[model samples]
Target chain A: SQQGEEDPQALSIQEGENATMNCSYKTSINNLQWYRQNSGRGLVHLILIRSNEREKHSGRLRVTLDTSKKSSSLLITASRAADTASYFCATEGPTDSWGKLQFGAGTQVVVTP
Target chain B: DVKVTQSSRYLVKRTGEKVFLECVQDMDHENMFWYRQDPGLGLRLIYFSYDVKMKEKGDIPEGYSVSREKKERFSLILESASTNQTSMYLCASSLWAGRPNEQFFGPGTRLTVL
Candidate 1:
């Protein structure tokens, strides 16, 4: 079953603009991680935010996690045409066995030049 | 660099035939996983192994089985392929279980069942 759900199923923005997406999960999680996938390819790990951490930053990617609300948001600053891809939010619940992750349907982002 | 590889990038099989999808990781990670991705369903775990010869069922295990005979290799087997089983299959490996470690994924194999 999918534990997380991403809002704004699709988003389109011009290059240099910022893109933001939100993900909400059902249960308490040990960690929330974001992944990016190009068309017809595997996913690449983007950033990870632990349950205890409120926010984290890697390059232009910023992730915020709010356990109280069971939600997380990912922000991409200065988007580029090359940044166009599908982003997914995965949650590893505290009770989840063997590091399994429940992934959301994902949000497709398109950046136009 | 950590690397994971799948046996095929594309495969076509007939329904009711036995199918095998292979995955190997060079990182020597103790944990490996198999997931199937559909159009709207992001990804669903079919099976996972924490160590050689140890397997565990994931959320959707029906019509699928797995093998991890060697530490670096994991294989997902379909006893009798069905049209619904046609999807993008992904293989991933991580350092350990119950950790904050990230998983490394292969390019994925798109299987078509007729």
Candidate 2:
């Protein structure tokens, strides 16, 4: 079963704007990770945030994790048309088997030029 | 750089036919996974292997089996393909044993069962 569910099933924005997506999980997690998938392709790892970390950033992407609410959000700054894809957030449940990730339904972002 | 490759980009099979999906990783990662993606259900894991010749069933493993004969290769087997099994099959690998490390995925194979 999917432990996490992303908010805003779909979003449309113009290029050079910012896009923010939210994800909420039901259980405690060791870590949270994000991935992006282009149409008719596989997913690409975007970033990961540990439970102990509140926020992290890479280039124009930023990720924040709040264990108190068991939620996380991914923000993309200055989005581009190439950034159009479906974004997924996966959570590693509180278990010793760390390789398992329960992915959310995903949020589709369409960046139009 | 990490690279994960799949045997085919698209496959078509008949119901009740046997099928094999191959996945190979060049990074010698200790972890590998097979997932099926549907229209609404993002991605659900079918099986995962942590070492050579070791396998574990994931959330949805019924009607599917897996093989990990070597550290770099993992294969998913459909004992009897069914129409309901049609999906985009994805293969991924990650370094470090039992860690939620960054995973590299291959271009998925879209399997259509008729």
| Isolated chain A TM-score, each model | 0.99, 0.97
CA RMSD for every model?
Answer: 0.7, 1.0
> lDDT at A61 for candidate 2?
99
lDDT of 1 by residue, B5-112 (tens): 999999999999999999999988999999999988999999999999999999899999999999999999999999999999999998997588788889999999
Pairs clashing within candidate 1: none
Q: Give stretches of model 2 more than 4 Å off.
A: A96-98
Expressed as tens digits, the lDDT of each residue in A1-113 for candidate 1 is 99999988999999999999999999999999999999999999999899999999999999999999999999999999999999999999888878888999999999999
The residue-by-residue lDDT of candidate 2 on B1-114, one tens digit each, is 899999999999999999999999999899999999998799999999989999999999999999999999999999999999999999999896555588889999999999
Question: For candidate 2, lDDT tens digit of each residue in A1-113?
Answer: 88889998999999999999999999998899999999989999999998999999999999999999999999999999999999999988768383788999899999999
Best of the candidates, lDDT = 1
Model 1 chain B: lowest-lDDT 10 consecutive positions: B96-105
Q: Tell me the lDDT of model 1 at A26.
A: 95
Candidate 1 error regions (>4 Å): none
Q: Could you estimate the TM-score for every candidate? A: 0.99, 0.98
